[model samples]
Target: MPPVLDEFQGLSAFDAIMRHGNLGAGAEHLGISKSTLSRRISHLEYQLGQPLLHRQANRLIPTEAGTLFHQYCQQMLSLGERSQMALDELREEVSGDLSISVHPHFLRGWFNRLLTEFIEEYPGIRLTLTSNLQPPTREDDQVMLWLWEGPTRDSGLRDEVLGHQRQHLYAHPDYLRQHGHPQHPGELASHDWVNLIDRHHPDLVLHHPEQGEYRVSLPPSRFTVDNVVVHADHITHGAGIGLLPDHHVRTRSVAHPGQFEACLPEWQGPSIPVSLHYPFGHPPRKLGALLDRIRRHVPKDWGQP
Candidate 1:
């Protein structure tokens, strides 16, 4: 093996000189005197046993051998930088602050447990969670969680999808019994509709593998809720028939048996994807660790009914 060389400073000086094409500019850039910069280049050349640079008019030009040596020098400098960054990241992983902006809907389910467990496991991290109904806007330290639908939009932010949230029609047993259970999609129009806020579309669309697509115009709803829990509560309390996420329904069903039952179980509504977003680059070590925890602990079939 080649003898180990501890010449990072000298290598850096040479690289700076080559990049700037002169000793004056390179020394200025490195915040060193011309004499000090010249001494480093001389020492480096003596060790390598060749002239790395020569005067060509006003500028300093590298020789044919110097060109090859400069390439290696650049590689060494880059490796040193990357190595330092890795060490710094390792240090940051142990203790740092992380800011997260999450949609309020995500806090309703297993996400709270996930956050609780993460805080307990990694006490070093200072996690700040903010609630936002809109998509991310800035590229900074904060990581954002928002609802995604269909194919990803051309938003410049990078995202890691956690899971999907699928909606299906649900109603309380009492309401269905009182209003008479509807068998066909067309019969749904006669029943009272409970709409979620922002779902202004007149038609309710559903799809199936064998039966194809189904659409029905919704009548004016008696209740329009912005909060998911409130919306689910209204449906469970026999207020009206409404669309609810499968996961919420499952959790409710397990917690309180027969509270809400699926209506037209064969057909499925639109699927909303949950995604975590950050700026386009490697996330900070603290954020990276949290992301790893989410990926490992968050169940793949989290949204399944």
Candidate 2:
């Protein structure tokens, strides 16, 4: 074995003893039995061919050689820590590739804007974006963004809530004008529904502040798509009433005035909880910086549906 590797434990034990000024405290600090620490120190002394410490009463006092050895050990430890810090700083400065898996619907609206800003802020980071309906199988250092209904229960990975997105029912003005607006959730069944099949069930559930919860069985629809963007497009063109995240509807309304209108404005759909997931450990400095940026940019409230 390499000399440093062979002596590392002994050196560490000696440093801990010196730092704590006694064998008992040092053993506790190193999470080792006092006998184990004493054996290590003895082995170290045997290797050096000299006693490095003198046991005086309840304390361990370094002999002349021990004092010299302690100084050298301090220098060695300091140099090691400084080298690590320098390498970490260099890693942060150097260019690196970051892969992120996200839902396609998130590629637009405020998320897209935030992503663009992230890219601009960190030109050294080359970002790879993958769009999938399901959370990608996370690699060693890759980050995954999940659009879920509630808190994630996986214990193997670290999950952080980015924000909550409210889903609301919306339709084109033309469709509502022709079909006539439904004043209540119960009347929704009689209308033509453009549904995002991925997010909706056969039965639609709506929540009211005072009326509580109501479930409406959706009729067989001529239009149903899995993608939220496509679903929004179908709603914009007056296909049928569909559920969309509040941000999408709000952004669409701003870009195209009088194009779409909310259906049953009094009721709200379930809020989709957005979370960012990564391997359960300290990430590389570059990836950590990117994660911090994401957390800072995410809006606290993505508007109410």
Candidate 3:
């Protein structure tokens, strides 16, 4: 007699029991009752005409045959996973659940348009996009997009540099008209500043092609905001002069002309690299398609490499 497809479940149960060295732990891990787990293993033993596991001081120790069989079980399980992956790849259309976590800033301006287009293109795909500040930790999350400050040290994740987010001081035309527009970086000190709540004293390091670096200590912000969109809203609504991403400013300018413009056109802000991280393997078609879509349609002004 040959083992049928259903026997793989028993093989998995046996493997879990062997790996955990107890029925209780294995059952808990598999989300099954101990009795149900015992039945599966007992049935597996019955098929083999021998006892696979013996009780030795609360531990489920595998017999010699069981020990040899466990190794084959591991190989079988690995093959099963590969078979499923192969089937997914061979599908006629890219379709499946794709989950992505991105920084909150990425969700602002123009990103929605890209998302709308992606949904239209891949109607079969079930997509979940989350705005997250923390790094990706969940194994089930297929992709993550975040601001990369420095080199990545996590060996478990595979990452690709998407672009650099360059920021510069911006202010509303109304505010500039009322407060008097600053002609120099030194003149910027007197203006009210809107900043992130996390920053105790946000320093502006402006770089010029000709004038060089000018580090300015920002005055304590009168308006502190936690959200990036709110920060931009305040700046656009005459709250104060604030640093904003170049791409975001451009998008806002196009959407609401003369609402916001750069304080100093020549000087540029620090470029924070945006990276895409995924589990260390060949990404599924859905994830791959989305990545390709982003690369293809990302705004040229976004400063992607």
Candidate 4:
């Protein structure tokens, strides 16, 4: 005799009966008459060489063996569903709606270029992008591009560091000419400053290769902007000296010509980490393809000096 597990229909009947607690409802769920459902369960019991269920007044109660068998049936059904889903993913085309949340600065710069390339690569995938200062919630089915400044705690999400951006002190040429260039990091305190309200600190810190670290007390800013692009714009228009990511300054240089100049060539500012975060499991095929495309197009030294 073959194993009772080979008869999938028998397993379904038993599971439905157990779930509904009555043969009539089970038969309705399976779209079969109660008589036929009864025969399937009877056949299943015969194959196992035991009476699986005891018929009560209004319901079918599982025996000890029946309860154990029901557990196996549930596991089998779950495995089958997962196997079918895996097969479907393999056979299906990579096409779906991919929602992403990204920092506004990236949307304005290198990330936009990567997005164009990604769309060209996968014409079937529709992309929706939102710019936000904070990461998206789990309820939102969206991937996020995040800038991690310090050590990130383990959040059980999938986080892949794409690259790093080096922060540098920059001032517009007009501002530099008017205020005169600071020869050393220590002299930066006297300059008018444009600062990012969220990112900048009250005390400016700089690192020198030979001289080590220098901390300068910052005065009131000439202008403060919350958005990175706007912050860069303020610095480009000679609002004040601002510490900005190198990539942002490079992107801004295209339009502003030679309006921007690095203030302290020898001092290195902090490095900002760029990362991609998504749910911590097997991503859908379309999202996987987009992630691959981004990995290919985005500069390896994204936030480097």
Candidate 5:
């Protein structure tokens, strides 16, 4: 069989069977009867020489091969729907499946809200948001959002700097009210300190890319959490004073003299790069639309809270 037609046949039949559990329902969906559906399945089995479905009581259950085939069929169908919807989006009428891979930290505020609004306005655009631990593998990733300090030399990735974020220390006014604000980074030890652990390393190793130094056995954790957002939340609730990015602490703190003051602001890096990476040239329709929407919506220095 030719590749495209063969792939389509496998996907469609797999889709039909998954959608309708029994052979009768699947046949009805395809405008064929149960017996014809059975014959087709039998022929498919003969060609592949394996049983796709298990013999059961009045219903068909997918075997292991059938399960894998169903997942592939689902992905293929999503691609088709995404293509149709993407073309519509280009007409200034948005539609498609906006498949994205974002880090856990980036899914805050406008990023979260943009997803909500994007789906609502362009109801045809289905979303499959996946968590990205590192850089994207596929060129079809459309837009990828990541935060890091300084240039990405030798990263072998093409991207544009969207914004620069500054990390600083923050404490609730209530916490500061009870515990006097530290005067120096050295004084960071005196309080009930909380820390965000880089889960990739949990032995309390720290890296200050700005200073080109490592502070091992740091992040004294009366409380230490893996996720930045959770650590930020604990700080917000006065769990303990900890370091956080300036933009992320905005939900609760007013930019003022006494509240959430940075103890050693000078010690922080010269703004970390918050960037968007995508394949060169015009992005796919859904991704292009999403990328534009993100730049328009996101704040200048939001991150790592």
Candidate 6:
């Protein structure tokens, strides 16, 4: 007969210990004590009739069998998470943990305000915002909510087109007033261009509306920056002309007595597609609520309508 292993039967606690590799850390993750966990693992080992882990320097290393068990444990936890997501989806409740990765500029805009309102509406749902561009690490408990820039149909993820990011040419009112705004695209070369030095995609300049796209190769920085928010800051301070996303820069004109114009008509720019991605079927409840709130607030111009 199989021995009793009731205490350490749940996949969650097992996964937590497997993820951390140390007794104290694993116990901390499970909000338990090291001795209690040790007893549980010892019992489980007796039930399986094989050693699952080896001790070294007060740490735990998974035995060969333990490795296979750990893999199955992860899959089990994933299924459990989906089950919880399903129940939440069925209940139509948005109360849990919501995790998402976003562009840095989002923190300064709607994503910021949205959280406040969402919290006020569903205080039970905890929202975690991250700056990750790739998938969240395997051990991360929070579900990933990444910001998108285009139609992503091939990534094997279940994703929805959330919005479209419209970009525009912008400069400080003071700078434009001092140098005068360009009336045509060709004239843009004479003025200083604030380049966001992206290693993957070269700084685009010399736009040809008829052709649809342009990537200009220019020398070192008139104003070279890697962060979009930094570029926004520079433009707000009247540094130089730069390509700014309309989502970040709301203003359109050059200047008024009390206001600053951020973009001009002649140099109108492009739009990037944005989306919300997750695993197949029902996602977490907290994720649904956050997505709903975003969708509710996102304007028709954002591409949903």
lDDT of each: 0.77, 0.76, 0.76, 0.77, 0.63, 0.64
Tens digit per residue, CA lDDT, model 3, 66-92: 998899989998777676666657664
Each candidate structure's count of clashing pairs: 0, 0, 0, 3, 1, 5
Runs in model 2 deviating more than 4 A are: 1-87, 139-155, 303-305
Q: What lDDT score goes with residue 9 in model 4? A: 80
Q: Rank candidates by TM-score, best first.
A: 1, 2, 4, 3, 6, 5
lDDT of 2: 0.76
Task: Report the lDDT tens digits of candidate 5 across residue range 13-125.
Answer: 65788788887788778776777677777777777778789868888899999887677768877776666555555566456655666666666654677789878877778
With a 3 Å backbone cut-off (N, CA, C), the pairs that clash in candidate 6 are 148-274, 149-273, 150-273, 253-261, 254-261
In candidate 5, the residue pairs with backbone N, CA or C atoms under 3 Å apart (3 or more residues apart, or in different chains) clash, namely 96-125
Clashing pairs in 3: none
TM-score of 3: 0.66
Per-residue CA lDDT of model 4 for 201-271, tens digit only, reads 78877888899988878878867777888887778778888888877777767776797899897887877
Off by over 4 Å in 3: 1-88, 138-155, 197-200
* RMSD, every candidate, angstroms: 4.1, 9.0, 8.9, 5.6, 13.6, 11.9
RMSD of 2: 9.0
Candidate 4: what lDDT? Answer: 0.77
Ranking by lDDT: 4, 1, 3, 2, 6, 5
Please provide, for model 2 over 18-71, each residue's C-alpha lDDT reduced to its tens digit, 9 standing for 90 to 100: 899898899999889999999999999999999999988999999999999998
lDDT of 1 by residue, 70-133 (tens): 8888888777777777766775644566677766676666777887888888788777777766
Task: Give the range of the ten consecutive residues with the poorest summed lDDT in model 2.
Answer: 140-149
**TM-score computed on alpha carbons, candidate 1:** 0.82
Off by over 4 Å in 1: 1-10, 24-52, 64-76, 139-155, 302-305
